[model samples]
Target: MTKQPSSLTSIASIVASMTAVAIGNGMMLAYVPFALTRSDAPDWVPGAAVTMIAFGGLVGCVIAGPMIRRVGHARAFSCSMALVILSALAIALGMHPLVWVLARGLYGASGNTNFIIAQSWLNHASANHWRGKAMALFYMAYVIGLGTGAWLFGQIPADGNLPPLVTIFFTALALLPIGLTRLPTPPAPAKVSIDIPMVWRNSPVAFIGVLAAGGLSMVVQGFTPIYAAANNVSQGDVANLMFVMQFGLIAIQYPMGTLSDRIDRRLVLIGTCLLILVAGFLALSATFSNLILLMLVFALFAGAVETVYSIANAHANDRTDPADFVPLASTMLVAWSAAATVVPLMVTVLMPVFGPRTFIYAAMAVAALYALFVLARLRKRDEVPAAERESFELKSAQMPNAGALVEAEARAE
Candidate 1:
């Protein structure tokens, strides 16, 4: 019998696909609002448009598992990229606000499908000991792509269709590596129940952590600029704030993952949530004055909030049988998508009533609730011993494939 090559051999192509998706996402995040602002749309239009993307993501999460099973990862990813390209063209064509909302939603859904495919493939390919480091590299690539996309946004003129066109070009470029590479496809996942009650029973901290982190992440990415602007921060500075936040998110992944591997992951999760809560309150109270301090706070908030997702995922893995990873991960991704979809709309209502700082308040509330839940869970259940626990791997709800990879790995063992 011939020996097959390890999945790790395809790492380069996986990372490339991840990077492309991230860049496209980052570009859209910056471009959509800017384009809408120029269109003389009402204030709610931009936020609603961004929220539509999350809503699409929720829809994508529901379909991606089945889609990947039917078509294989490469083709599924290709389809996602095609959707992104078409959506970008639709936006560039100066569609009506309502049409743009639908287009953006398509972009969100397709982008999420790409994420699931890449992450699943990576998880399936990675050796056990190398999983954490592999995830770190994946995260680094994702963050760098986002930062680069934001930089591209600055270079492109917002006045014309150029931004979306450039986004389309990048989305197309992302397809190249996938099309050219001969990557192995994972088999169809086994049928397993994804009961929310079972997930919480297994790991409440992880369950709540995912929900809170989703809310925190969406608020920061979708509304931070608006929050800054309302506080009289300059537009350029708002861009800088997001850049610093992304840098913080990139910088923290490996260190946090390594730390979680060594100790109680719940402790790491709790500490990070506290930090995010503190940063959120500080940002709210100070009104984002003192540019340097504001950037630092934003960075801390972004880094901590983003890290929670991975920690929660790792924590959930600690509690579940290896075979259950796929269903558990899918459920968590759905939880994240639901939170991301609803939180912004909730904030939109709150902002008018509570003032522009409402986003910060929303973040703080999430952080506080998560922290409290973690503490309570600690009291109710003993920690998984470090010796017995799986090594912490930095994952995002963005990549739904990790679960499938974990299931495959379990079967191999």
Candidate 2:
């Protein structure tokens, strides 16, 4: 029998995982955009430049598990952190737009690999009893990190070299815990052939959820700061708004995750969609600088669900065999990548017409339709018997073989 991971490992991993994600968020919000804005590039140049890096990140997510398996998590994560530090130093010096974009993309991959590897570790480490709660905790750290990053942007000078060097220093510091930990190695995952049709068949909604979550969330993340500034919303208020929103995500993730674990996953999914819709409407009305109302809307919008990334992972986990977790997660991440690529371009187009707040409005409008579609699916499937529904156990006896991962290994061979 495989020895189950201790809670100590779980806790320590969570912290280390949290550090990776936090610093990753920090780097993205802090370094990349700063470099882009500070570059001698034209207005449109920064967008493409930022996308260049983010697109690579999406690629990293797709290949994360196999990379981890081949290189091992610690090594992969360490390398990523080191790259992030280097990227930070580069951003502090303020490179050319294309160079900044390339560096950001390279830096972005570090976070992607770190997250995927950490998640693979978490999936293997979890006992069935605490799986949902544990996943919730994993998500909570990410939530905190995202909110903290936005707030830190306000605290740190966006165009200055100091924030990059300083944030990089802190990110480098995050490597210590993982290095010091004496965690045992995870079991080798099973090697299965890839079936694109099979993954789509198993988790279509989850796949779409990946789109809604990634597209909407990216629209929010990449543009919200710019949006707030464009609007009359003060910088302090914007930071506070994000802070409250993250805190709301923190408040809700565990309960919502556990709630999903209990009920039919569809209902849980619908609930998530509804939350986004409400958030959308609230944000749409948030054109006013009414501080209370803005924060309230942000809080509502942020709370009730945070499934953007985590839910798809959970849903994929739910529908998949335990052995398929890593591979399936990789498949779901592609959905994130596809959405990330498209949404920014879409929102950027909207900016000239609706101003910067257009991203949030666009997010809400998209989510409303998505929620409706999901609701339709739920209603159509309502007659299906619960027992007939396949519920997944997140853990598998062995891991699924990701095709891309195998190809990479074959190339290495």
Q: Which candidate is the best by lDDT?
A: 1
Off by over 4 Å in 2: 9-14, 20-24, 27-41, 45-50, 62-66, 126-128, 187-194, 232-235, 252-268, 308-318, 323-326, 379-413
Q: Which stretches of candidate 1 lie over 4 Å from their true place?
A: 1-9, 37-39, 191-193, 229-236, 253-256, 285-290, 397-411
Please, what is the whole-model Cα lDDT of each candidate in the order they appear?
0.75, 0.58
Native-to-model Cα distance after best TM-score fit, residue 292 in candidate 1, in Å: 3.7
- Residue pairs with clashing backbones, model 2: 53-105, 189-399, 190-399, 322-395, 322-396, 323-396
Query: How do the residues 312-346 of candidate 2 rate in per-residue lDDT, one tens digit apiece?
Result: 55665556565554456556566666676687777
TM-scores of all predicted structures? 0.91, 0.80
Per-residue alpha-carbon lDDT of model 1 for 109-130, expressed as tens digits?
A: 9877777777777666666656
Report how far residue 405 has shifted in candidate 2, in Å: 8.1
CA-only RMSD, every prediction: 2.6, 5.5
Per-residue lDDT for 150 in model 2?
58
